[model samples]
Target: MTSTGMTGTDTTSTGTTGEPGDRTGAHTDTDVAVVGAGPTGLLLAGDLASAGLRVTLVERRPHATGNLTRAFGVHARTLELLDARGLADELVGTGTTLTRLRLFSSLVLDLSRLRSRFPYLLVTPQYEVERLLERRARAAGVEFRRGTALRALRQDAEGVTAELAPPGDGGAVTRLRARYLVGADGVRSTVRDQLGLPFPGRSVVRSLVLADVRLADPPEDVLAANGTGDAFAFVAPFGDGWYRVMGWDRRHQVPDDVPADLDEIRGIARRALGSDFGMRDARWISRFHSDERQVPAYRVGRVLLAGDAAHVHSPAGGQGMNTGLQDAANLSWKLAAVLRGDTDDPQALLDSYHAERHPVGTAVVRGSGTIIRLAMARTPLRRAARTAVARLVTTVRPVSAAVTGMLSGIAVSYPAGRGAHRLAGRRVPDLLLAEGRLYELLRAGSFVLVAPRDTHPAAPEIAAAPGGVVRAVWANPSRRGALLVRPDGYIAWARG
Candidate 1:
């Protein structure tokens, strides 16, 4: 998902583009300038524009994009994030949902018992998520300028100035300025490069082959996958007749972009899983490496990076896209607050983003790396031991529960001090409210204070204190609780 290699690029000092506004001296472009139109940037652009901020999303490519989606599984927590934005239903409708996570032939992790409206992982393409987000962004009035490569960025105490190498050959570099900027470019991010932030990690594996094909006769386990001591192979349905085939042969450690063939994938599958489930009629094939890397810092001055630009991991648990989408949700509101001058300490609010999200990104890298390495164990004895341990954990209820929660992203929570409200910094479950679900209220893109009529007299004062930015809603008198739900559907504060 890297577009940094696009050609027709030139960055000169004093070439300007875009028709300037009616009243402007230095041509301040928009309130926020977002580089890269991936899922993270799309979500952030939509949220900021919906909040009435002038936002422009810049893409290095010339068009919207095709179906070359790399990530597949949208976990329960990511579905919850999209649900809050009123887009999850459409995405979930197009994708298949699985109640259990198949780790191997013997051990399957059940997600049916998780406490979420979306209790299962939705098997959908990364582009499907992007389409829904892009639609919302267009409706919210975000200016999308494709074919514009962000060449350079400079930031001061006021705002950020962006230099873009325009579309065609010998295209002059256009200048844009905004109150804030974000780099959502994938793995080889140009924005991250300009900022000089160190992406500190090594490549985990190279030349991992990926294929989309049809199975003549479906296997008993559609997510049929295993590591055969020397290699690994996995098969997951595309919600259509096609299935995704991913495999890595430890012996064939070749370079990426060396044209991959179908026979190579077939051989790896045969060696790893005994048979390839009669796979044929390959739709497409390619190769890529898994990297376990994280940026030292997400924010540098007025610029911040999200999505693959900030962190990348082995796509072991299908967490890459979900983690990036969640990162967008986490950063959008804080950016809106700071840009609109709603927070007393804007820098502190901005700093909170890195403080809160960096650890989550780190945890994801560690977990995914561990899973991939475990699957890459070479010896026969070690493979058997892993399978045995996996079976044992699956048999233990709490162990299985913990694994499901962590993999599905529901187990994540922030650090909130111990107040009387126990739900602070916890993900608020989608409650059945009189109007709709708790997430339905979050579509307003503001903090919602939901209180039982009998329990919290201070709801009125809390809303009043925040200058009505905190919206107050009431439940039945006997419900006996109050919850201040953040825009992201996490409980900021709650009382029972």
Candidate 2:
């Protein structure tokens, strides 16, 4: 087992016997191996490959499925991230722009108050997002091993060794060696299970019914109800008289226990919509209960976890996918740095990922749990308290904005490390740049400095940088380059 020149052919099994030909062929080797082909994994693979690192992506699914509309909303911060990679424009072109998010109960709180150029949400299914990212990853020369599952893993000082099995019917196992491994698998991740990490959280008592229905008479607005008498629903218009209806089953029924018949779905719809709405077509339906769980740590040894593997909470504010994408963005650059041998201190730099992301995950779980609990309060006294709080929040602009900002992921900030400026953790606003937008600057490479207008001071000495592309840009404050921006679309350091 030499450290160098390990490709797709070398094979040595510890316990399980692999397919005869598996060891005969060259084994695929890369700087990083990513488990799961979901949004986070695909985005991470694309980023790592684009950064000139060999990346191998493994997915247990035999092929891509575009049927499930799991996550339907993309927040402003996530939009900014995609925009940075030149994918936002394409996404906005395909998806509908949600200008307003109206909370319905005894009162309404407009989500448009969140500060940003993209003050609204984007309505795009999770499948579309994965498709775009997968395309980008393939274009970047990433090797995607579809229908592959990790059978076993062993890490040493040099790199990680993963034994992968093909999907369906026990097939030959292939050995994959990489400098690092990323677990982006869903809640029940084999990677997390192998790592012996504890996922601590409680499941909600009541289960909810979700459906994508084409209504004969659709609601005029996007409505999110906290407590609507007997049911709670979050309705978002997806164009063409289609609405994504999500509501809690007052009877607290599970998917298996209750029939998924159209009549049942329509009953739930009518309860929330206040009308016997005729559902012409029902695309998909499922029952799910809210669960709040987060991994104690995002990293262990050479393996790391992202997305649902790292944190799982109620989808109250649609923060799941957005939070996972942010996880990919934040970890990609640092991993690239380590792989490129820019620094010898791997543990210190890697620890920051957990430190920065854990708090945000905690906040999301706590906040979303609070919102869901208040909305589902059964007693009259609790309902009154919830309504009073909502009204009071609406009356105070700052308080309301702050609450909305947290849900939108605009309030996430990182701690300033070595060589980091005050703006390191803060998100950089979209500004006009010579290249095009401030996000365009990030597409080139990581650690960018937007030089102040009319000021050409000596460039900061950036170490282990990627060629000359990592230099500062002289931005025109009047047009663009108003301030320096980070890869995560946050202000690293800015000047007026």
Candidate 3:
């Protein structure tokens, strides 16, 4: 969700924002300055602050965000990320989970087969996730300045300086400097514009209406979805009585500004799903468009981008918000390491943020685009063929497993260097430790050296070599080798 277009100013020449800090000639006022307090920035800021870095989060919106609902599905991988932060179970309790997702009326994708503890998609409002993250951030000492917008940002070898416009019109401009900056400010990011990054892609669908309503007769399935040649519709419970309904009509391809009504949504649902399930009494309704755009690079000098600021996708597989949260998971630890002087080459480590995440962003953009295009296939013959092919492919166990893995993001991985361990760059499954589980240990937000109980006596020292890396002994000593798992639950290094 973009802000009502930023002030479109880039006054970086003189740091005269009428603040005393601006006249101090200091290299940096804080460790990190994060724009946008959404899921991405909140997670990043919380992680950085937890790692002892001073972080400031800026949000253009007021503290009271009314009915802020968007992005309903949280995939398995994203849930695992939250688990590492000790928030997964609490968040899971606030939403409903569906083990299977139906597409095009037939061809169900089974999420129950996923290996993750969270093997299903969680159906929750975007605000629920944000609320939890914002609470964690506040507890971790993240300075949040609501009703503040980033007017401009200038980066140099030393640090980045940001020009901020405060709450009201004619409010005095403020200057903030930090060692690094991040743009998690959604699609229309002012930080991105100041960096001159091009978000190159086009809109995938127009006039898609979203609403939270009550179903007079709820569908037996946890989720209901189908796409007729002329329209597409999906409905899922919010765990509350309210169900989120998304529908699009081919005949009514109006602009996003056009007000959406229950009548229009009911017509589209009936056409696409054969029935509206007696939908009634809408709680919220809005019209919008979906796009598949991504920035060329996620990093530029001292500034980096995450979340919708770096990439955005069609709401086809519900990957938009999950991907952004994962981006924060990938970048936060690396940034903490660099800022804490845990790395020899900070630039190389920072560059790896783009290297690892940009490819994932690209894949999500393409995958979501393909799913949306196929859902909107015009001809009857094409739709039948797609359904047939989908059924056939899904019947094959490996193909179905692969499909679910990618869609749920459990199969996502970074590149390993030459001669690296096979486990390196791969996701580390939740292993049983002597005292607890792998994810529980990750709540410390540090590297974890998981060693077999029979490993060398020096294993503890080796784990300690990485500063705060925690040493975990396997409950099953029969397992071989020692694995170094990153804070994000990915294997970093392993030895037989």
Give candidates' CA RMSD values in order: 7.3, 7.2, 6.6
Model 3 regions more than 4 Å off: 1-27, 167-169, 457-467
What digit string (tens of lDDT, one per residue) describes model 3 on residues 17-121? 222112234567789999998889999999999988899999999773455577888999999999999999999998999999886666689999999999999
- Give lDDT for model 3: 0.82
State which candidate has the highest TM-score. 3
Which candidate order results from sorting by TM-score in descending order? Answer: 3, 1, 2
RMSD of 2: 7.2
Ranking by lDDT: 3, 1, 2
Question: In model 3, where is the ten-residue run with the lowest total lDDT?
Answer: 1-10
- How big is the positional error of residue 358 in model 1, measured in Å on the Cα after superposition? 0.3
Q: Where is the poorest 10-residue window by lDDT in model 1?
A: 1-10
Q: Comparing candidate 1 with candidate 2, which one achieves the higher lDDT?
A: 1
lDDT of each: 0.79, 0.72, 0.82
Indicate the TM-score of model 2: 0.87
Q: What is residue 402's positional error in candidate 1, in angstroms? A: 1.3
Candidate 3, residue 426: Cα displacement in angstroms equals 0.6
